[model samples]
Target: MTVVVNENRNKRARVASATHVAGCRMDLNVRDFAPMAADEPALAGGTDEGPSPLEYVTAGLAACQLVTVTKIADAMGLDYTGLRVDAEADVKFRAAQGAMSPIPRFSAARLVVRMRSPEPPERLARLEELVEERCPVSNLFLDAGIAPEVVWAIETTG
Candidate 1:
């Protein structure tokens, strides 16, 4: 099916995802896109075809942060050679499994951005501030009462 996107329509973006499940493993299909497999580990009775759902959430947070920082840096005239974001979350599964009430998504999360840049610490600090405010994924968690601890580590070079 050819989807005709109306340019005059609302600017909001939308994506559709469908999943085929068997046991603890499933293949996700996105519209006109490559299929991705997801599964739990052996302990959870899965073949581990790909990362678990929570893992994908963590990865998306990191990717969104990186992209936000990059765009902000470009606009702020900050020069950088390389950038990387390390992300981790305190994920608790018992809640989702009905074993625990008041299901917690992630108790906490941390994002550390490592960069090789010629810019000074102050500029990077400003960039970090903007990213925290602007990154949609990070804000999604924050608004849900899971404010992630953010860190900026830069190796300055000329």
Candidate 2:
């Protein structure tokens, strides 16, 4: 189904390959992150900050999906700027009835996609639909369970 789009501008999300050793404590890889630009420093801390690897994983789900939404708006010719996903999470043990696990059992992230576009609700909803269709990362978590499965692609090797 071809949705008519005026103004051929586009927005897309890109990622590089990564690796994380299954149970090794030290060698872990992360693919999703905004680089520490000159504007933002790496260290602004008390004991609470500097996201653990799990936090990065959770955040990636939200940010990657929101980028998908942004691309949807762009393709549909919705004049917009400044899209953001404000996400929050809580981690807890799934079956620990009474034990307080010092380590988090699993983390949760609630995504609040902040969008600034001048489109009606129906159109916006359609845009979201298109985004969901196009976003592999979002679909991976939403439709299928988040199990790791690497696929082979015959594209340019980077």
Candidate whose TM-score is highest:
1
TM-score of 1: 0.83
Worst 10 residues of 2 by lDDT: 149-158
Each model's backbone clash number? 0, 0
Q: Which regions of candidate 1 fall more than 4 Å away from where they truly are? A: 1-10, 93-104
lDDT against the true structure, each candidate: 0.82, 0.51
Backbone-clash count (model 2): 0
lDDT of 2: 0.51
Q: Please give the distance, in angstroms, between residue 135's alpha carbon in candidate 2 and its true position after superposition.
A: 3.3
Model 2, residue 33: distance off in Å is 10
lDDT of 1 by residue, 1-158 (tens): 12233687757766867476887788777677788888877766787878987888899999999998888888888899779999999977443545544443687999999999987778878887788888989999999899999988889898
List, residue by residue over 53-148, the lDDT tens digit for candidate 2: 556656776677677776667666776556666645565645544665244544434556665665666776676657656665555555544432
**Residue 24 alpha-carbon offset, candidate 1, angstroms:** 2.0
Cα shift from native, residue 21, model 1 (Å): 3.8
Q: What's model 2's TM-score?
A: 0.52
